[model samples]
Target: MDKAIIVFSRKGLFQKTLSAFDIRSREHARKLWPLVSFDESRQMVTWVSPSFENGRLRRRAHFRVLPTQTSYNPKQHFDNQENHRWNTVKESTEHRLAKELITAEISRRLNYGLGMPWRFKDKDVSNFPFLGNLLLGADRVVRLCCTKI
Candidate 1:
């Protein structure tokens, strides 16, 4: 099981065992999970959120990414390297969930009355770096590219 999924499930955000569709969806959440850090001691995972204070909105988080030891064994070193290379290559594949997260984040902020002027539009796309191509269908899809907020 993915470490992030386990942590999120512990937080009641997901089930311990994910279905096929859930597994696919959770994979996207995994990448973003690295942006935050989990506290095993407190059983809390913290990440940045947009907060409004003093008539302004800003990013805030309660915790930072924790460092972990990387174990190395001489016998498995070669195999580990090969596996890491393959995983790196696989990571280049398209990320649909990331785009969806950005759309949801946009909607959440909009609900809080932010980004009112920069509604999803070609002219305003430059301003919102988190957003990408907008796809409209029975289910509205907003393409997004991941970047540091």
Candidate 2:
């Protein structure tokens, strides 16, 4: 299986979006995280996984925004109104793309597991300090791990 680590800055869009969901519980927060990348030049947001293949580390793009789609720009209006409208459109577009990437990644993970049930084993929880709550109550762990994704 491939391994990946994604670190989102406190002020970044992903982090802010997660915060907006008001994930007060540790279990819920833990299950909502996804691995993704954004390419500025291509204006693409992609679901990616890093793996060791043939003795080399390779990054694979599982899902990505197409070039043609990324070129989207809001229609021009008056000077000030146009800039404001453009910013709004851009932010919304980015948010939508991020959500799509996360959804694709979650679906990929589920399919990759071949329909086996998700198990938050003790050992796995121990390795991740944020998941310590699982030790307190295994029953509290969210079964539908993709709820936020």
Candidate 3:
């Protein structure tokens, strides 16, 4: 069957949201990890990976903040095989028409529930407006260069 990695998330500053929850502990997937359509019409990422053209790789990549709890996908965000699928799904998500996206795109998840204008603190980055934790309509996405990268 063809695959279409349709990430289940709301629209935001990001051109696209993650398609499926990251595979965490093989029991639960981290929320918002891009979904795998598994349909040939779309895309699929196997435990292993397939190669692509170099130019294709460079063109599809766009920078955005990531979550710190990478334990969800302990496989490493840049895992050779998985990273390709991750990026493909992400690019497709962002380019699709906004009418198709969901409310959660610009909102946040909270202990009480999920909603908008969230105040999330990334201990990873000691600053306000952290990535994923955005002050939408506020103009800038908050990002802290705390990662040694």
Candidate 4:
């Protein structure tokens, strides 16, 4: 199975509720309408296809996970209704659980494999000169074309 690393979003708590929906919706929209056009009236691009008579795209199905299936304990965490002090134990527990949930959901839906531990090193810095030469060549070509125009 392929290996991967899971990184939590900076948005913290809100990411839990929104991330799954966002991913599914984006994937569904991409599959349903490979190309989208902007509507001047709405001032935004939509998933509606020109081939469809109604110019409407089907809604994406929502994914739900029961609380019993995962270690997530929503009651232990703070919410807008409760003004409880921040607890590191609760935060860490929830964070870890969230990661597990997201990783499992992504794996199940997208057919991704389990995550593996890995490390990164800055060994590629030596290749900078080669990249710089390629960029310089492209810049020269662009300059030549601009001058000709």
Instruction: Residues 1-149, candidate 3: write the lDDT tens digits.
Output: 12223344355322242322232332333343443433332232322122248645423222222334222232453485665765555534344444234323433233234435445677777867544533433432232222222
lDDT of 1 by residue, 1-149 (tens): 11322334454533343222233333444543422222233222323333668977664323333445232233365578777777765534345566567778766655555543324545554654344333321233345454322
lDDT of 4 by residue, 39-72 (tens): 1121112232122336764543332222333232
Q: Residue 83 in candidate 4 has what lDDT?
A: 43
Top-TM-score structure, candidate number: 2
Candidates in order have lDDT scores of 0.41, 0.40, 0.36, 0.32
Per candidate, the number of residue pairs that clash is 0, 0, 22, 0
Clashing pairs in 1: none
- Each model's Cα RMSD: 22.1, 21.3, 22.2, 24.0
TM-score of 2: 0.19
**47 in model 1: Cα distance from truth in Å?**
60
Clash pairs detected, candidate 4: none
| TM-score to true structure, per model | 0.17, 0.19, 0.16, 0.17
For model 1, what is the alpha-carbon lDDT of residue 62? Answer: 33
The regions of model 1 sitting more than 4 angstroms off are: 1-94, 116-149
What is the per-residue lDDT of model 2 for residues 1-149, given as tens digits with 9 covering 90 to 100?
Answer: 12222224456533322221243344543454432333333232323333568988675424344345443222332466766766655545666678778666655655554232334546654764332321332222222222211
Candidate achieving higher TM-score, 1 or 3: 1
The stretch of ten residues in a row with the least summed lDDT in candidate 1 is 34-43
RMSD of 4: 24.0
